[model samples]
Target: MKYQDQLKRTLEFENTPTRIVSLVPSQTELLVDLGLESLIVGVTKFCIHPASLRKNKTVVGGTKQVHFDKIKNLNPDIILCNKEENTKEMILELEKIAPVHLSDIYNLDDALKLIDLYGKLFSVEKKSEALVSSLENKYKDFRHYIKDQEKLKVAYFIWKNPWMVAANTTFIDAMLRLNSFDNYFGNLERYPEVDLNTIKEDLDVILLSSEPYPFKSADIKELRSRFLRTKVVLVDGEFFSWYGSRLDYAFAYFKTLHQDLSD
Candidate 1:
């Protein structure tokens, strides 16, 4: 059977899935939240959430590449994938072995929809609904706190080697907007490599994420020197990047982040 969500097309199992493989780290964490820890047979090397699971689960492969032999051995009933994270070729090959659920996330609403879909797929509706409700309350609190504040003009950097910034129509941008921060690159396309000189004018903040590039404290210091007036912050990449269960922590992080910026 097929189940469709706002983010992706999920293939339903005859019953609850017994053996599952997650290609995306965030989804792996979500699976754990849904009480599928013991049922998840395989996960990518990057599926480090619930950190103990990392030590216990089988490391199938990375997002771009999967160990066909390892996956075949695990005999997963269903495979979870993300459009932006996994390559097309990888998805095609995985489909030949097991049913593949492809999730395409562009914003917060899509994330929430996927959570609900997962609940239905795994027969964990109550758990998923409760989590979503908690997240909604947190988001409401954040809005209430920032309602009267000035929207700070900020640039969220995701990658560094080529200097790419999160642009419009992306999850990160949506999160930034939710926190009442104006994305400086909102006019650009997704994850564009922008010239620093282009964004040197009137920028309020430069956010450096902890992953994809792993921006360290030193990097923040360097950025501070370059953009003397703009505040440079080392943002938690997971809080901003992961669209799954990690969102529970993201709202509180955003609240603290906004307060830090104001101070």
Candidate 2:
């Protein structure tokens, strides 16, 4: 079968891939969902979605650093990666070993496209269609639920130390807009370092994600002290940031979050 990857390179695979190495954690989980687990030979340490797989699979390395020797030992027929998650230098290095399929995702549409692509790659069309249909229904319901509500001006913080925020070009920002929340920092290009003092006091809400920097309950209190008028909410980072199967739960979580803010 001839297949073209996100990079627009076409290749032929005579049979189903027997040995696959996934570098991106989210893509790893998506591959497992597509029922390509038996074919997966290596995964990064961060690929901890299906906890059972974590215990059994060989850990290649983290997102930025990979054990090339370990990867060579696996002798994978195919490798999956992401443009944003994995560095270009690393992708170039991996391409030297095997055909690397890289994905670039920035919105929910891209997420669905990836799922469809994986489905075609793995010959799991039924499963992929089912998942996509479910997600579509959830998204539609959420959109309808929020159509009548007032859009809240929100600031979604992803990191600390430098104080970075999700900008308009990101998947998180798309998700926020879909949920009827206006991103205060959407004008910025990417995740930019934001100054709290510069943020308007009239901002409706401030959301602290639970990953990357892992914002905790105490962090919310601290933020609240500075932005007393804004509702500081702790959000599951996976639901907002992870562009994999976790998106299935994001709509429900958003519904509850919207309700919480309404109260």
Candidate 3:
């Protein structure tokens, strides 16, 4: 079978991949949900969903760094990765071991496309189609609920120390738009760093994500002190960023969050 990755690279395989290794955390969970749990021989340390996966499989490494020896031992027929989560160097190295399918998702359409492709690749077309339908329906419902709500100018903070935010040309920004939040940093490049003070004047709400940097309530208090007029809320990073199976619940989370912001 011949398949092309999101990077526009074409790859072929002799047969259906039985042994698989997934480097991206969200994709790992998607594989399990697609009923490829037993076939998934290896996953990164960050593939925390199905929590049992960690206890069962060998941890190859993180998103950017991988243990080549561990993956080689797994003898995977196919390896899964994401353009943003895994580095070019890592994907190149993994290609030598097995055919790699890289998913690049920027919006809901791209995400649905990836899920559909995964179904075809794994021969679980029915399941993937069903999941996508469910997500589409939920998203429609959420949009209807917020149809009358005013769009809020939001600043979604993803990292600290450098003080970076989810800007334009990124999945997080796409998710923010779906929730009817106008990303204040949307005009800028992806994940740009900026002084918080410079953006405070335009932001109606400041969202602190709970991953990569793990912003807590304390962090919200700190930001609230600085931006007294803005509404500060701690958001689940997975809901806003993870573009795989986790998206199944993201709209539901967004509904609750929308209500919170409205209040």
The lDDT for every candidate, in the order shown, is: 0.87, 0.88, 0.90
TM-score of 1: 0.96
| Per-residue lDDT value at 213 in model 3 | 93
TM-score for all models, in order of appearance = 0.96, 0.96, 0.98
Which residue pairs of candidate 2 clash? none
> What TM-score should be assigned to candidate 2?
0.96
Candidate 2 residue lDDT tens string, 1-263: 88877767776788867799999888888888877788899999899889887678889999999999899899988889988889999989998888888888888999998888888887889999888998999988888888988888999999998899999788899888888888999899779998888998879999998878988888998998988899999988888888988888888888888888989
In model 3, the clashing pairs are none
TM-score order, best first, reads 3, 2, 1
lDDT score for residue 93 of model 2: 92
What ranges in model 1 sit over 4 Å off?
A: 5-12
Q: Model 3, residue 150: what's the lDDT?
A: 84
Error of 1 at 36 (Å): 1.1
Cα lDDT for residue 241, candidate 2: 83
Q: Name the candidate, 1 or 2, with the larger TM-score value.
A: 2
